[model samples]
Target: MFRGNKDEVFVRQALEQADYACGRWIASQRHFDVDPTSLLEPLAKAAVVTAVAIYVETARLSQLEVQRALAIETVAQARALIDRLHPLAFGGGWYGGRALR
Candidate 1:
């Protein structure tokens, strides 16, 4: 889990939103044929949520340089953990690389 109160709140909000969207999307897709790969979508969204939480929390840092560095590092770590748990989650690409900038 991550540190910081605001960060936790942000992550919770993101996760709730992701859940809502995923539920809606899945329901909408029920009419169509299902594929095994479709199950990975939620995992990918979770990775993105983790990265955004890190970015949001790190931005509160006092120093600009430190904030930027920490954001990238934390996001990378989150992505790595997600990728390790579900290798197919990100499709072999780092998530949220552009969001940090």
Candidate 2:
């Protein structure tokens, strides 16, 4: 949904892993390989793999911050503009007020 090539690698890896996992689950579903009840082992392995990937990837994502810097910069620029128009003046008689320096 994000507008860039950023998710390509992630999506590709997810598809590959999903396919592999489905194959493994299917393989253990017949009177051929290990006991069909052993599907939980591979399922558990897939869960662990997905969980580790999520942990590591989310940690990395937290480190990406150029967009945050740009947002802060935009707010600073807006503050400067507002300051230019609203200089506070005080401590002058009815004749005039001192222009804020």
Candidate 3:
């Protein structure tokens, strides 16, 4: 139970960090009209994914039966918001030069 609580705290912190990154990306986009392919987008996405993964893993390790739909929805929403806002700004890849995968 103590470990579960600790993991929950960590997950919350990660999610907060992810939210901050998303806010930064949104500010950059709104103020500077930055491209979605910029570093901010990937950084925000990475943060968001890391947070969601942490939550999912914590729940698994804790033997807590949580619905994964929420996690999936969170990721989907973040991706859509990040990509939809700057549809025309996707000329370059995420890393700027070439695709990572």
Q: Give the TM-score of each candidate.
A: 0.23, 0.22, 0.26
- For 1-101, candidate 3 gives per-residue lDDT tens digits of 35658877986785566564565653344432444343334444454445344444643322121222223333345555445322223335554532112
Report the Cα lDDT for residue 84, model 3.
39
lDDT of each: 0.42, 0.39, 0.43
Q: Which parts of model 2 are misplaced by more than 4 Å?
A: 1-40, 61-101
The candidate that wins on TM-score is 3
What is candidate 1's lDDT per residue for 3-71, written digit by digit as tens?
Answer: 669876986886677664674554343422344333334444444455444544543322342333233
Indicate the residue-level lDDT of 45 in model 2: 39
Question: What TM-score, to 2 decimals, does candidate 3 have?
Answer: 0.26
RMSD of 2: 25.8
Better of 2 and 3 by TM-score: 3
Q: Backbone collision count in every prediction?
A: 0, 0, 0
> Rank order by lDDT, top first?
3, 1, 2
Error of 2 at 12 (Å): 10
By lDDT, is 1 or 2 better? 1
Name the lDDT value of residue 30 in candidate 1. Answer: 43
